[model samples]
Target: MAKKAKKIDIRSDGREFDELREIKIQAGVLDQADGSARVDWGITMKRIAVSEKTYNKVESLREQFYIIPRGKGGKKYLVDVPAKLLDKIGDEFGDYEVVGEHFKGNVAIVAVHGPREPIPRHVADPYRAVLRFRYTMAPFSVPERKRPAPGRREIEISKVSREALQGVVFANEYPMTAIDIFAELLSADAGTRVTAITAASVALADAGIPMKDLVAAVAVGRAYGHLVADLTKFEEDAPDAVDFPMAVVPRTEEITLAQMDGRIAKKDLDELVELGIKKAKEISALQRQALKEKYQRVVENEQ
Candidate 1:
């Protein structure tokens, strides 16, 4: 059976936030990032972008041109894109000077942050730059919820999310610097992590950091035998559900990270994986198209 749409109280002025959720990019949200913008995910909101900087306006690194004096490291298609989408993205990257502004929204917001600052003294892990994830919920975001301090669960999720994000980020150039992403959930709906990743890449490009490709991700879930486009907290809490989250770079047809929590059978797992891959590819294609258009617009304006 098909599910009904969410209901809201109507007002003369119109229902509160009643409309199809859409993602749009507004320029110049932040100056620090080589590229930056604000993301409005239906009911949620976030501001994010990426920035790049030198190790030392001085050059005291253990190695020359090594941003940290040391460091080490680490997409998608469109139906509109040709069968040679991989070749196409590469061509675009090479021909383009700035790979800027990638943003999408759900019911919440997500922002991408930096590839700046030399490696922190604490993160002496020389082989790679650190990709960090943080999740903070505004006190008034939810109903009757007091502003509470961050708990262990949020911290754990942040670490795992970083793993998913870093899997795609090129940390070597930044070396000692940390790329810290702040995801403030003004009103979280679900699929926030995927949105975070989608936005983070745009910010990275704005920072003008070199990257091999663009990354895109999505979450597909099963509840009561029905599949959902993007899950929300309400659906996630349903009595019968299997939490499946997956991240992929569509252009490459590569699945970098996936996890299935809660109760799920093999058949359900297969379904989730299949659905996730399908949707992620679709989302990736849109990002590529949007980015190409965005890049072109920025260039035309410059000319």
Candidate 2:
């Protein structure tokens, strides 16, 4: 028996499925970081890339890079890329940088530090490099101050975020290393997780980490039985709402992260996942453009 889809009429800002709130992102906002990016969604800071001298010091960190797989047997193809080409695909880290608020208001910041040496030594794995994520909300991030500590929720989100981003990174390329990401919720909002993921991707690219593709994320929810994109804090709390956040490698359409609250039918889930992919691809394009613009500036400055 087939069940009919219910009509949903609720909306916070009358945004359609294909429409998202105003989005703005700028890279290299911070001069100190190896790479930084800022978005109206919030801010992000990154540290990556090394000087020719520094490269010599950490030269052992470099490893073979691969691209998107093709053909049936799934045998991966490797390419011989020079240093410039390494930068082209974000294989090599460049200067560190940071990004801050362009539009005021409270927004999250996603910060990444190091493809460098891993501290403590114990956490380092001999077989492959490791990636760790810490998701935190500041005391003043919300209307009411939160406890200044990493709670259970933060721990859970951090674990999930690491898992989500791990797939995109060439961890094996930096064996015995650690890539640490800190996503701070400076301005609390509904989709901070998604915002952090998007910002983090830009930071990684800015840092010049080798990657197959950039990651993009968005949250979708069912309000009044209708699907919507980029759920705000208000919409996320709506009664009976189904909130789902997802991260994807747009070019490959590979889902790296997905989290859902509230039950949904299999058919609805499929539809929402497709919708998420569409939105993520759009965001990914913007990410690529940001990197392109940043590098263009670097080239111009060098000249």
Candidate 3:
């Protein structure tokens, strides 16, 4: 008799193999910039109620918890807690009520400066506008305070990001000019490059730059023996992890950016790329909705 196959366990965060993290995007967020957008891409861990006593002990660590009032007369203090500590406290604090939510994810803000004259006249292209992308992470963006300077990784990401969006843009319309995109990562967990690219696309559109389509991006890979979409840091650090990040132009189904880390079979690589394209289309829809909402807000304000 053939032996039954063992079932693979759910992801560490209890997500399906093809499930993406929750994403929230807002356009036209920066008043000074010609166009701007903010992308919050991450998962929300559970909210648990702890005694007022526990709250007091950790109250000084305000940065970590989001405090919410629960119960009648707002007597109970509920805090959105991180998942790392969830396993340690289990059942010891009595039956805690789920009252608040704690989000752990990446937050990126992108601003588009101009279709103005290029800074160095020599670098300007006579036939098409020059596209430039700058990607930076805040000092406090990671668990450890990252250095403020742009490192090699940042430079590489900026180069690839500029390449990714340059194709979709109708640069010929604004010759002898430069369109500059600045992407700042206020918080990061993983997939920072992809998040920045996604936000930059929206910021460009918000600036009224002509484009073939909004470029959408996502990271897909294999973790724990299963092909997955949107690998979290936990999955990215797995012993057998394979991370592949791709950006796509949804209208023509053209891949603008593709990068991979670690190894996988050819067949698996093909499957992963297909999964990335599928997820990119879903992200494209969200980008459109965010732009629509921004204009809707504008209309409401005018009235």
Candidate 4:
């Protein structure tokens, strides 16, 4: 018979097992990217950008804009406009009704580019869009200034975060093109991978990319043998800690990204997943609210 896992009192700092660390997602930190967001959790801060795709033709071909229904039970509308009108449309109204909730630090930077023109020819695909991602941490982003450039850790994160987002984006719409995502750690934080994924989803929407739904992510860990949502550096470094990071689409309740470290009992898996999903929904709500607030500002500026 297998030995049973020991149960330990996980509560520390007066927190409940289901409670998350304090979180804040702030959108619109930098205007240069098609969309940008910042998430602050504990001591970490993360900034992300979703930029306009590079191909002019791809952007010009789209002929519609989104709007919520006018009244109760009214269907939401996608008003078709002339292709030429889209050409006349400015960059200001691109984000529409999107927002990001929160996560951060070890300052990871992930940039998603393209859905534009394909370059170099060989990498282009005829049937669907090509997405590429790169993740890196800055030399100055850590407590001890570290060497810059891509390393094994950076590469691993890039791949996982990309996978987390691939299912949600409407990649088929831009065949023969490439969409690139880049994430850099501007500072060190325990949950940077999840934070980057969360921010990237908002950035894609902000850039007006077609997506089935937005993605949100968060980390859950076992501390003192108790399941906890949103682990911090302190908890992550704990000798008994077990970490699980996940990304999901709230509309479909689909999990696009999930990774685990340390050990978990088969019986405990269900509760951990439940906790992560519940928190993901909460985070998704905040993302929508953020977008609404951002668009509100644009409306005010226009008036």
Candidates in descending TM-score order: 3, 2, 4, 1
lDDT of 4 by residue, 1-303 (tens): 222344545243334567655556656666666566665554211111222331222233321121111221222212222222233442423532212222233443344566777787788989889877676777876658777867788888889988998898888899999887666656665888887887777767766779998899989877655788887665665556788999989888899989998877876778888888999998898777766778888899999
What TM-score against the true fold does each predicted structure earn?
Answer: 0.63, 0.73, 0.83, 0.72
Off by over 4 Å in 2: 1-10, 42-106, 298-303
Candidate 3's C-alpha runs over 4 A off are 1-8, 47-100
- The predicted structure with the larger lDDT, 2 or 3, is 3
Each candidate: what lDDT? 0.51, 0.67, 0.84, 0.65
lDDT of 2: 0.67
Give lDDT tens digits, candidate 2, residues 1-303. 222343544243334544655556666666666556665652121223334443443334222121111222222222222222234434333442111112222365666777768897889988778898888888987768899889888888888778888888888888899888777767765777887788778877887788888899888867555777877555565565688999998988999888998878899889999999999998888888987898798899999
- Give candidate 3's TM-score: 0.83
Model 3 residue pairs with clashes: none
| Model 1: lDDT of residue 252 | 71
Residue-wise C-alpha lDDT for candidate 3, range 18-94, written one tens digit per residue: 98898999999999999999999998776777677666654453322222323332666666544534554444345
Count of residue pairs whose backbone atoms collide, per candidate: 23, 10, 0, 20
**Candidate 2 lDDT trough over 10 residues, lowest sum:** 63-72
Q: Specify the highest-lDDT model's number.
A: 3
lDDT of 4 at 94: 50
Q: How close is candidate 2 to the true structure, as a TM-score?
A: 0.73
Positional deviation of residue 290's Cα in model 3 after best superposition, in angstroms: 0.7
